[model samples]
Target chain A: MRPRLFTPGPTQIPERVRVAMSNPMMHHRGSEFKEILAGVIDDLHYFFQTEGDVFVLTSSGTGAMEACVVNLLSRDEKVLTVSGGKFGERWGELCVAYGANTHIHNVPWGDAVNPDDIKKFLRENSDTRAVFITHSETSTGVASDVETIAGIVHNNSDALLVVDSITSAGVLPFKMDEWGIDVAVTGSQKGLMAPPGLSVVAMSQRAWERVGSSNMPKFYFDFKKEKVALAKTATAWTPGITLLMGLRESLSMIRAEGLENMWANYARLAHATRQGALALGLELFAHSPSDSLTAIKVPESIDGIKFVNRMREKYGITVAGGQAQLKGRIFRIAHMGYYDALDMVAMASAVELTLRDFNWNFEPGAGVRAVQRIFMEDE
Target chain B: MRPRLFTPGPTQIPERVRVAMSNPMMHHRGSEFKEILAGVIDDLHYFFQTEGDVFVLTSSGTGAMEACVVNLLSRDEKVLTVSGGKFGERWGELCVAYGANTHIHNVPWGDAVNPDDIKKFLRENSDTRAVFITHSETSTGVASDVETIAGIVHNNSDALLVVDSITSAGVLPFKMDEWGIDVAVTGSQKGLMAPPGLSVVAMSQRAWERVGSSNMPKFYFDFKKEKVALAKTATAWTPGITLLMGLRESLSMIRAEGLENMWANYARLAHATRQGALALGLELFAHSPSDSLTAIKVPESIDGIKFVNRMREKYGITVAGGQAQLKGRIFRIAHMGYYDALDMVAMASAVELTLRDFNWNFEPGAGVRAVQRIFMEDE
Candidate 1:
């Protein structure tokens, strides 16, 4: 059997998107590609829910994060970074790497960052140039309250509110213009329902002013050059043509489903998965779980590494093992993109089967029953 | 009819490679992907003809160029750049953007840079840190003698030899280790027979020593982090997973054809294309033409812009128009990846028909006859 993907970022691609990409290659500078790009740009405005500028870059999500840092602030500038998981810590690392004077607000793993702490950091360090936040930390399956943090930063300091919404943008209720976010970035994977190549970034008017004066030396990630090319319905460099073709279909799928309905579907899937895990007497790993994925703590009697390996080797289900400090302690089941309630039930059933082999105390059909109940009640 | 891609890049992807990418998505951290990455890394050494470190980065070829500059030299360091066309000019621009003390050696648009002039530049400025050269200037279809320049830099100064082999690596005879190149970079779209997302870089032992002490602040393009991850058959960041799958098949196709045969095929195609254009009494653009593409100067009586438009509208063909200074004066027909001699015949036939539409003095079938003769002779 073909292995199923239940990971957070590199989710399953829909059939139409795959077929669209499988068609013949087209030149980037051709009129056909320009029309496709213009349509993508229009669709991106709906994706980001912003009246500001939105750009597509041909890199992974981490490159988008670096573009945000290099474009918004100069060297030696003060910034506040919130760290609660692996992805959150990357913001601080990026700041340090680019010679920014970063003040990291550390939060406990499996817990979300507090908005009050961000306000306190801005108050203490009155000259912060930017504030970095991870809307959905994929490593811990925790979602921070970005809207509250954006409010706190906006009311307190002149710092630009930059967000890494790689796993949150299309899966959750994110309104870039409504939240007054300066910069928000996401990848083609995860909530975008495409493959992992292109990354999209939306900038507010406030962010564009800072980008013009930022002294960071950049070329590939230069926002101004990209903006100039975007005016002509082109990209600064030759983009990933096949991936963008896939994205055009994925974005169309999202639009047809309606962004609001897609977010609601993800919420339902997350709810069912969480209930199924709880029904098996498994403990959750995150204090505030993201709708994107759910992290479950491994039982003490079970070998976490072996449990994960068996899920892949025997069941042909590819779920994500915990990263960094939480390695072998937890496993994440994603409900992010191109997944539905039936998929959640299959995942819950796989967990039940895997647990029986580990000699864990769990009823055979209990987890799957709980997932079905959640969907049945909603219907 | 489906539109044929005769543009330099993004080139025509092989059907097998596209089928490979259309398979179901797999997790990047899974064992299956790790095996794929390991195989790709092994095959890349054969692709670049290097025993030194080879890395695949998820960005455009321009990003690979920027990676070489940022990882090898610090700010305010002296460097020499040779510019003969648009792609060549980019090397100098990258150096200046990163605050390097850049000295650009400008050659005429259609001519290759003189190797002796590079010797003079290094001798006059003995403190040069790196010498940058474009192996194939794509805009003008000019090919520089990289082997001769590599020797000049190695024998003359302590400068590192960095080459932008984006259009030349798999199409031409570029032996990274054999030529003593310090750094060489190429993109997937041209010679690799893959889509346009991933770029590969090969670095010598001498370049690694400089990378250790280079103080340019970088995160996404960090070669150290990539090198460490590569040792484990992984990437520092989440890569373009689908593109990498496509690359595996493309590299396999390259290996099956044998690298030497692929180079000879490109040379034959370039020769046939040049002879075909010359048979119609057309002038060639470059003094030293690259084997990857052929640029033909448009006759003054024909409207260049309309000639290009009619080639696309009347017939389903997409060839690249000249860029920058050569724009509207010349047109380029690429004989790069996934193209055979029949594709060359079709391209030449299209050019003949387009010229006839503009009432130019050219006999029908002369160009096609020359192309057919070349292929028949080879058989």
Candidate 2:
């Protein structure tokens, strides 16, 4: 049986994208690859809704996130980071590794930090040169208030706003210029419906200027050199050519669907999932959930890992377990990338079955009924 | 028409390997991916013939090369680098970016640096902590004397030997422990018969100890964290699952052919290419050529770029031109990955047609006849 991917990343790839990846290998320095790379850049700019430099790297989203910190700030530079989930804490860790003076705005798990808190931290720490935030916290399925946070960062000082949009770029609304985000990074697998090799980093002019002055140790991820090479529609080294071909196909699919419509679709699926979970008497983990994925707190009697494993082993439905302190307490079901109403229903049914097997009392048809109700109500 | 890829990297992926990349997406943290990752690591160790730790990263070979330098050397540490070809020069560039004191053994392009020269340099500069060299210089199709260089470094001082095996790993003879190579870096695309996203870095215990004390900024490519995570057969960050799948398939093919036999095959093909080029009245660029690729100097009257472009446009074949100062003087034909006698015949035929188009005044069947003669003579 083909297992459908409900996991946050390595999400289900479309047939067309997989077929695209199987195309014959091409020389990376050739005219054909250049055309493909240039097309990907243009499509990414359109998707990001920014005229800023959008570059692709042959690594996961974390590499792009690291590039953001490494390129933007010098050693011992002040940075304010928000840690509300696993990914949020990753920013602080990277900053510390880079020898940056970091001020962490720690928040409770499964909750978004308030924009006012960020403003207060920045105002008090006048020496801070940047603020790092996660647009979608995959661990808790919470989306940050990026628009408000960016505005606050700009008004407070000259601190640049960097966002890890790995899970939110195509699933939700992310306007780099309009939202005043100085830097945003995303991966290819999540909402892009491609494999997990390519990463995109979009940077504003201000961020590039900062990169120019920063003296950090970097070569492969050197944004300045990469930009220079990419200007001629090439990478500083051999790129993931197959992944780029898959991305070209995926971007076409995204364009065919339209960005606004894709966002709307995710919103609809997230609402249906939340309604379905509630109908099954399961509480949501995040106060403000992201459209990308939904984290549901497992009952104290039921182990979250076991729940996830059962879904995989029994129903061939893969989901994600909690990280860090939330371990064995929550599981996440992603609604991004190649998902539709049918997938939502299937996931709801799988969840209902898994809960029943775990001896949790829930109505047999409650989850499916709730999703259908949401769909009907939307109409 | 499907184009044949003869470039050094982004080489021709085997049909089975391409099929493997079409494997359904899996959660990186799941048991399935972990199983696959563990298998890949074990196979890598078997192929590399080392008991040292082998770490996989989601970037090109350059990322692995940088990882070796940044993770093992502290700022201002002295390193002796050999600059013979494009990749050899990369070591110095990485050292400069990381604030290291670099001493160069600058050899001209298309030539190998003598190990005695490195020993002399290390004797003069006793403060050098490491000596970096490229095993196979893809830019010039030259293979260096890494074993002798390693012996000299070990005998003279405590300087470690680092070899960039990006283009040589699976196609050539590289016994890490036997040769006393402290660090070896390779990519997936060149001789591994896979795509270009994955990089492998194998480090000895001594190098690991160095990594422990070195203080450099790293997160995504952090070997310490990656090794820890890989103990449980998982990656520190999301991996390129599809590419890993392709690599697994490629390694299986390597195992089927056996490492030593595969190396012999590469050497045989390289000899045939050299004989064919000579029969076509072309000059070989490198004094000591590598089995991974063959470089031929075009006549002064014929433009190298024009020859390469015409081969692609007319014969649907792709080859590489020289880099830097050597551009328009030499063209490279890669015989790495999934190639056999038939492929060689086709490549020779294309080269013959291409040279004729440039009015090189060569006999129509000269190149093909030369390759056939090599085959018959071997029989």
For the candidates in turn, chain A alone yields TM-scores of 0.99, 0.99
For model 1, name the residue pairs that clash. Answer: none
Clashing pairs in 2: none
DockQ for every prediction shown: 0.89, 0.87
The residue-by-residue lDDT of candidate 1 on B164-218, one tens digit each, is: 9999989989999998999999999999999999999999999999999899888
- Candidate 1 docks at the CAPRI level of high
Please give, for residues A137-204, the per-residue lDDT of candidate 2 as tens digits. 99999999999999999999899999999999999998999989999999999988898988999999
TM-scores, one per candidate: 0.99, 0.99
| Model 2 regions more than 4 Å off | none
**Model 1 whole-model lDDT (C-alpha atoms):** 0.93
| Share of native interface contacts present in candidate 2 | 0.92
Q: Write the per-residue lDDT of candidate 2 for residues B1-379, one digit (tens) a residue.
A: 5689888887888999898888778888877888889889989997788999998899999999888888888888999999999899999999888888888789989899988999888888888899899999999999998888889999988988999999999888989988899999999998889999999999899998899988767888888988888888888888889999999989988988999988998998999999999998999999889999999998999988898899999999998998998898999998888898778889999999989898998888989989878888877
